[model samples]
Target: MEFRGRQTQKCPRCGGKALINQYKCPDCGLIFAKLDMATNKAASQRYKNREKSAIVFVKKVPIDLKRWKLILYTVLFGLFGAQYFYTKRWWWGLCYILGFTLLSVCVIFNAPLLNIWDGGLISFFGLIVGVYGVCWMFDIFKVCLGKFKIPVSLPKNELNAVILSKEED
Candidate 1:
């Protein structure tokens, strides 16, 4: 028998090699037919249930979050990350607050704005202001476009459940 051209597959659980025409894993005795049933019947059913629930309970923004309010926060207090806080992104809000504070401190200390004329554009003050400005503008743009990614969890209630008896064809 020529073994060189025979097709083979890897065992999922045991990571052992097996011929594609074989029924069970040679090393782990895992039945390929049972594995197929488990994946197709149970796993795919679960994924379909999840997908249906995801579509039914879809919310563009977080709970109690108004689009107008988010836009207002981004326009007015986005430099300090008020919009991020409202969207429940705490770490990002903290970063914005920290950047604003740093900028304020630099201004208080009368730090020079730029060293571009001195052939040293890599200086301190202007970089922080420039980056902060760009981020603030980008956040406002995203808020306006209604495309900001809000991290909110869907309610795990019966309303979001895909009742097996009521499932459609």
Candidate 2:
């Protein structure tokens, strides 16, 4: 795509029109780069293809600025919410007390009415069922937000190479 503003600054590499966002130049040839979103690593994170957290990723083109920020913020919020629900076990512990007490009372009062009155069995059941329900809900919320974060970093070598390849994406 055409870059904005005047054709003042020349590519540090090619010394051509310098119209590109990045470029590279050698005595042999010149290259220029176009910022495209598909090539961006941040945008790719929406797919979680990253093998490591420290690995760098970039988008060829920056996306809608405000929208990208919102997606990132929302994903962070979702992560924290999921962590709180899954880990901070204070609330869940209380539920354990209430559930066991209720089950014990039902068994004691009605004898044969509740077949699963064994204490170990009932607590195991509550823990698994409760964890499953919460995890399921948290996953659903995160999946609904969709794509986000087209982050790009200008690498020195690639930026220089762009001067020679200065074609639009």
Candidate 3:
């Protein structure tokens, strides 16, 4: 008795074992030869470089911010960009704070130069404030949904491990 269809190794792309002559994965149409030792070595080298870069970046991120805390700050002080400040994005935080303050001042003082522009400056500032408010609301929503992540170098699980290690010390 002769066996007709012998099983082979699983496909790396789709995990299918239906390989054709140990060259191509029939199930996923992935050519195994495309991933030779040279390709794998190059890929491994790139990954190591990226990992090293990420380690350096994670080391620089002083505060590992929590999602809930970011949401809370976004909700409480979004107008003043408190969340950005916590994320170490000083430029964005300062811009938001300054923009809000300037707009408020413009609206409250009703300056003489603004009046000379026939309320144009007030209207322009109002539009800016409205746009900023919408953006702030979206930011709050994104933070609550865990979409607005901090730009750390390591993966989430590894980053958490690092944070735990730091706390233990």
Candidate 4:
């Protein structure tokens, strides 16, 4: 009798073994049709002929976020946490509102400024408010420079469509 090895395929992502007829990876659940076997030639194209495209196209992804609105919120309503609320960051917006409220209470009660050891709660509130202001200022700069991180997300189907279209090119 002749010896023969079992026919199997290895998943490129997880290196898991599957029957040769299998269309999807059992371990990672990656479909064989979606697998990208192309070399770095696609990525290397960005580096060649860098003069014209480098300034306008390279490294820039088209996202749904608007820089003008973000900058406007950061500059105009930053003290009220408007930017965070606009960006859908509820927890950060709540924190900013709470900080503002605490600062307001401290001011109303005239909490001691120089009495640090004697329960000068105003100082703590002031520090928090100051830090909040500094963060708001930093966010203004980041939004202007197009470096602010937004939490927006694309639908999975749309994302997959974009990926498949790029692969077709």
lDDT by residue for model 3 (1-169), tens: 1225765665544566753466665665555443321122232243456643222111111234555677779999988999777765567789899779977777676777476889887888888888888878887887777656343333332221222232222
Query: For this target, which candidate reaches the highest TM-score against the unseen true structure?
Result: 4
User: Model 3: which residue pairs collide?
Assistant: none
| lDDT comparing candidate 1 with the true structure | 0.60
lDDT of each: 0.60, 0.38, 0.57, 0.56
Comparison by TM-score, 2 against 3, better one: 3
Off by over 4 Å in 1: 1-59, 111-122, 157-169
Candidate 2 per-residue lDDT, tens place, 1-169, comes to 3546655445323344544333432332433333332133333342354333222222122443343443443345332333222222224335544544554554465434335464565556556556644643554453344322134423223332333344555
Question: If ranked by TM-score, best first, what sequence of candidates would result?
Answer: 4, 1, 3, 2
| TM-score for predicted model 2 compared with the true structure | 0.25
Candidate 1, residue 79: the lDDT equals: 89
Residue range 1-169, candidate 1, lDDT tens digits: 2347789877554567888888776776655443322212222233345533221111245435678998999999998999888765667899899889877866665525333235243346558777987999998998898767664322332221232232234
**lDDT, model 2:** 0.38
What ranking of all candidate models by lDDT puts the best one first? Answer: 1, 3, 4, 2
